[model samples]
Target: MDHVQHLIDLLRDDLTAGRYRVDLVDGLWGDAAAAALFRGQTEPAVRALDAGRASGTPSTPVESFARLFLLGQALPIGEVAAAFPRLRVAGAEELGLVVPAGGDAGRMRAALDLRPYSFVDTLGAGSWWVVSDLGEAVLGRALDKDHVLGIGGASTTLSGLMIPTPVDSVLDLGTGCGIQAMHASRHARRVVATDISQRALDIARLNARLNGIESIEFRHGSLFEPVAGERFDRIVSNPPFVITPRVDGVPLYEYRDGGLVGDALVERVVREAADHLTPGGIAQLLGNWEYRAAPPGSEEGGSDGLERVRSWVESGGAELDAWVVERERQDAPSYAETWIRDGGTRPGTPEFAALYGAWLDDFDARGVREVGFGYVLLRRPAEGARATASAAPTPAMARYERVAEAVGSNPAGLGAHLEACLAGHDWQAHRDDDALLASTLVYASDVTEERHYWPGHDDPVVMTLRQGGGFARTAPLDTALAAFVGACDGDLSVRALCAALAEVLGVDESLLVADLLPAVRALVSDAFLLPAG
Candidate 1:
């Protein structure tokens, strides 16, 4: 038996013998530590190694101990796969290792695509390899592994950020593990998750049951074809928006890679989303877009990442609202090497270097410099705005909107700014369902409310209480502002009450309409607010 197989067997024996029950397994390495390791960091590995060395198990083989400790416990196959690194042996050979029968590389991948974090774990791999394991783990008899689904933060983030207004229908585009579909099932009357991989769809169905969520329809196909002519009140996707080439003969994972070159996956997804949305419906997604960097401003003024997204929203002849939050931008070679590491394809190997070089060459040919990747939230606007198209779609809108600049590198301040703005506007606390019914609301405490008005405007709009240091302040509101603010009892809205207040406040409502509205809409666009359509 090989060294790795022995270790695998020993762990299996330990699991079967009830040495580590499912609940206790997490105690060994907490989820955060396990998650860090699974995402390919050396800190946890080094710490675990030192801990093993200190435990008087010198030469007990640190890697073996780590694997043993990890696998011996009854962790789901998917989570285990993610924590498995690119190293050989890993002590799996210390005992007789039984290859789950008929398991090829795809099946062996269970150690990789075990959960939602698998996407980030494998994001460095330019090839789509982890999806197969996701299928096996999610569908495996463990939790009725009916669907091999790769679960991770992106999946959950997309799920959590979806506009949940109890819509009649929801469509999960590129539904890898069906996480989005499962979440949508909570509010939408009917839900469907689609992917090109039949394996993924199978796992999506299994996951639906595993999570005790029912009535989700799973379909096998690419993008919109599976749900042609199907319009939905909400559409959510954590699609294969990674701009990478689709390797042939490789069963596409359908979770992260869209099988296209450079930003096309996102463009296509955005282009097509309008067709699937009910009028005024919203589609929220996470996407990576390549922003072309030019000379001079290359370091400072790289094309705003949000512009391309705006173009996509407007292309469909839909009046639209788009919010693009650029999280990280990596250079071509750095990006290439990063993805290679993700695929478990070592950088030292000649073949791996060649593949990476090809990726760089592809970028150079396209005149692409740094790649911009982030979340995209788009809404189909109600009809009748001037049909004029701008030269630059995103930044122009962002500038015209007059949102406070992203403060510092953190952007944490951005949320605070948005909160203060909402708090300052007409904030009506609704007692019942009457839109016109006004009730006297006394401040239970002083409310230091803030309103986000056009940068130059004088009206206090969005109303949020700032309760700190044991002091409370109540900020007052106008009639229009009152109607807007009073409507926000965790429900959805078609238009922001603040925009109406801008009209009533008689501040350049047009500028307020253009600049502040997008930012206000962005809060809803990011799923931070109840659907206030």
Candidate 2:
């Protein structure tokens, strides 16, 4: 055991010696080539490396490793071994990172995909090596159903959205390559990462070990089954919630499809999350929810996606705070094409046509008009959860929004923004309308106002308060609300501000206060306005 541990430590040291970092990798092949390589186009990077070799530019250890693992190029054992002096070809073989090339003597091919990933979060900048199954681009064929995925857009989105508030323990369900579990370990004392695939668990464990992260414990089980009857301070999952048809000829990619017909897996995760969370614990996830075709003569609009998610949270019958944001919704056909192509079945192929037809047919059978994708933040209510049994329980927080435009950038990442918003919400939740009116509040620094005048009119046609960070929310403000927000400098109480605004606008103070209270609470939840310290 000690020898195996020492072997992995050597692998880590060798990778560090190779200068495996985002900046160095980008510098190796130039920006355009790097961009192309990330898009699964290897030609540009291959040409760059070939051109460099022709120009007498010696390959660095990172370039050699990238060529072998990332580009999936089979190189002479001598060349690959030279890059890792400590963990040479023999040691790499022992670690199962490489294998002898079939029928090609003295050469080896990568058995997996390993790459350097870097990010900036609340804990500052960090980097790590991620190992996963070889992609279709490397295999030159369709991916296997149980393929493990490397760091990608969804992975980065979830990690960036993870709140870094210090926690005792966290549960990372469906922890594919252990990306979220690794990130969770930064702020969490321990993390239990569970996945249905043993292969995924093995890879996740390798990732944790490769990064020198000791706090994560990888387990093999589907969803909450691994830690049944146990609870944690936090839970994070980017589950296989893809909407896949169960019919014949339609492929079920294990990395995306959870085998439970259309969004049922997402529903299950949301509902079951309640039982696995300790009091005050929060579960963050990314999921897809179907937007069903509304019933005839329905008064509600076309989309019921947000409401369905709310119902899932309520179905758990727990007092939980749920803030779900629908980042974007894709129509049925678009959604079908996106996932179909994701499995490496290109358009114009017979396989692609068949799968696409199956997806649409499945959607039609269930009356699914479109699919909504976004972030879900659910918190098992704090304070021993219903500790106020003797008193009236506070209403659980539920805020749903559909944000279609690009969200603003935050240096410390969205996690801090979300944490602050949730904190602000908690502070204001304890205060009633009467108490809220008596308290002081300050607007966030990322907020600004914009006024648009039509035809050079003295009165503005539209006034808007825009949040530069958080979710990049733009709140259209009426004259009274605009004045109210402008006066929120933490100087005066809410009552004083409302009175001052009413006096200026010639409106009754009582009505003004009543109208602005809800909007003020809204701004607080959006991190536009925060409780004054």
Candidate 3:
């Protein structure tokens, strides 16, 4: 362990001195290589790197490091030694990061994938070197069952969605590679990261040590098994929610497929999360839900994907608030093709065809017409607000919607925006319509309006209220509502704005207020409007 720590310190120093960063590496390889790398094709990147080396100039330390680890290319032992003068080849071998290639001491290959990851959050910009199992690009075949994943699209997505608010303790369920747990360590006093795979736990622990982060505690168990009877102020997970058929010859990749038929794994997480959250605590996760089709001539339709998630939360009996956003939906065939290809199976082959058939058969057996993939946010209510007589009147806020459109991008990420939106919801939840009307409100700074008029007409045909951030919501606006929103400059109360608009439109003030109150509440809840001082 001391040797490991010494090697990690040397590695960190070498990586920092070499300026091994995401942007610099991208610049060195150019856009084509970067794009090809994203598509899981390394030929372009390899060619670019080789060309740079063939330019008759010595490769820089950063370039050598990227070629070996980022692109999974073998490097000469001399070059590896130069890249890490402090650790050298012997130290890298001691760290299990590289090994002799074909019993040749002159050449070495990376045993694991280690690359620099940089990001900007509310706390500011920083980077870390993450190490994980070599992927298909390096292995040149399907991943092993216990393969651990490095930074990927889903990992970054969940990280960006995490609320960065300070907290006492956080639970990172299914903390593969410890990416989310490491991020949580930045804000929480302590973080408990649990995973069923010991291999994953080991790699995650190494990552924490490599980055000099000591606030995360690693545990091994599936789902809530490890953290039983324990609660956290915040929880985040990107679980193995992929739907796969339970049949022979179908490999259950422990990194993804959770050995569950359909989307039961995600449902189980939602159902069990309430038991592990403190009052007013929150759990954010990524999941997949099955959207089944209605049977022939049946009056009652099949289960809705979003509603199924709602049912899981309801069954928890915790009166938790849930906000589920189905980011995208894919049909049965498309979904099968995606996960099948993801497992390194190529099209136009017998093996691919067999897996595709298995997926279709499984979906058909369960009457699954489509699969909806999305983000879910669940919150346990505060103390004294449990499902008792005193709290019986306030309905558990459950928002389930399909937001397939692009949300506004935030440079600091969306976590802060989500935190504010939740606060807005809670603020409006306690106020009656009359109370809300009596309160003054201001349009959020990120909001703008657009109007489309007919070619030769004075009246506009279309109006939209657009939000620049926080899910980038756009709502259709009528003439009266548009005028009312325009007048909300923090100088007038909601009631005064409605009354003035009603007078201008020659409508009854009471009727107009009744008509606009619901929309007003929605706008406020979504952060398009805020309460004025």
Candidate 4:
């Protein structure tokens, strides 16, 4: 224990002194090369690295580490020692980070993928060293069923969506590599991270300790089994929610596939999250919901995946507030192919064909037409909400929508936007129409109005209101509503703006206010406009 602890300290010092950072790496290899590497092609980056070195030997610390770690290339022990003088080659071997090359006893190769990850979130800029299993590129074969994955696109998505509000405790349900738990620790006083796979728990613990974050506590068990009776102030998870077929010859990778058929894993997480949260606590997660056909001769018709998620919240309890955004949907073939390739299975192979057939057969048996992938943010209603100005507060939010816009990187993520929107929802939900009319609103800074005209006409034939953040939503607007939105400069109350528009359009003031009030409330809920400061 002491040896590993001492080695961890030495490793941290070496990483810091070597300037191992995402941006620094970009500077080293250029953006084009870095992007090519992300797409599973390392040639461009390898070319750049080869050009920088003389006689195939790394000349710098970051370059040496990148060659041995990220590029999965063997380096001489002398180069490894020079790269990390504090934690030399022997220390790295003792820490199980590197092993002597089989072909050449004098060379060392990375036993793990240790790289610097940098992000700018709700809590400013931060960087950390993440350690996880080597990828298929390094392993040169399909991943083992229990292989622990490193950072990927899903990791980036969940980390960006984490709310950075201060809380007493957070429960990270499936702490794969402990990424979300580390992100949670930035805001929470303490965090409990749980995973079903012991290997995953081991990697997560090493990752948390490597980053010098002490607030995270690691536990081993499946789903909520690790922390059943306790409640937390916040919960975040990127669970093994992938829908995989339960059949012979199908690989069940612990990192992606839960031991369930179809999308039941995500359903279980959504249904049980509220029971594990305190009052007003929020749960943020990514999920896949299936669009299944209704049975023959049934009164209820088939529904989209978003509606299915809505049913999960309703069945769970009334105290839960849910905002589900379906970002993408895929048909059976596309979804099957995606996950198949993810496990390093190449196309036109027998194994790929067998797995793909199994997936389609499973979907067919379940009557699933398509699958939806998106974010699910749920909140437990606080009892104090009724004590505010209104005699009866509105029920918890159960809104669902589909968002398809390309994400913007302004604040790097939507946590701040989500936080603001929740606050805006609470502010407007307690107010009746009259109260809402008296309140002032201003369009968010990222908002813009788009006008389309017909061949140089005097007026626009079509109009739209677009938001640059918080799901990157865009709404079609008629002339009157566009005028109302344009007039929202935080100067006058909604009542005054509606009345003025009504007078100019020669319509009934009451009718205009009635028509505009619903749109106003929706805008507030979706965060197109905000309550005046």
lDDT of each: 0.51, 0.88, 0.89, 0.88
Worst 10 residues of 4 by lDDT: 385-394
TM-scores of the models, in the given order?
A: 0.56, 0.94, 0.96, 0.95
Top-scoring candidate (lDDT): 3
Tell me how far the alpha carbon of residue 115 in candidate 3 is from the true structure, in angstroms, after superposition.
1.0
Decide which is better by lDDT, 1 or 4: 4
1 or 2, greater by lDDT: 2
lDDT of 4: 0.88
Q: For candidate 4, lDDT tens digit of each residue in 1-533?
A: 67777888899999989988887777778989988888877778888888877556537788887888888999889889998899988899988889999989999999999989988887689989999998887777898899888999888899888887899999998888889999999999999999999988888888887889999999999999999899999999999989999998899999999999888899999999988999899999999999988877788887779988998998986568888988899998899999999999998999999999999999888888899999999998886774446576567787798877577556669888888889888888889998999989999999988888899698888889888777777888987899988889999999999989999999999988888888888898878989997
RMSD, one per candidate, in order: 12.4, 2.5, 2.1, 2.0
Give per-residue CA lDDT, model 2, range 1-533, as digits (tens).
67767778888999998888888878778999888887888888888888888999887888888888878898888888888899888889988899999899889999999889888888789989999999877888888888999998999999989999999999999999999999999999999999999999988988888899999988888888999999999999999999999987777888899999888999999999999888888999999999998667787666589988999999887878999999989999999998887888889989888998999999988889999999999998776443332454567888888876677878656888899889878766776787888899888899999999989589999999988887788999999988888888899999999988889989898988888888888888778898888
Off by over 4 Å in 4: 54-58, 294-300, 386-390
Stretches of model 2 off by over 4 angstroms after superposition: 294-303, 384-393, 455-458
Q: For residues 216-328, could you state the per-residue lDDT of candidate 1 as single tens digits?
A: 98888889999998888888888777666444322233455677777888899888887788766768787887767665436665555567666676776655556566666
**By TM-score, how accurate is candidate 4?**
0.95
Among all windows of ten consecutive residues in candidate 3, which has the lowest summed lDDT? Answer: 384-393
Model 1, residue 45: distance off in Å is 9.0
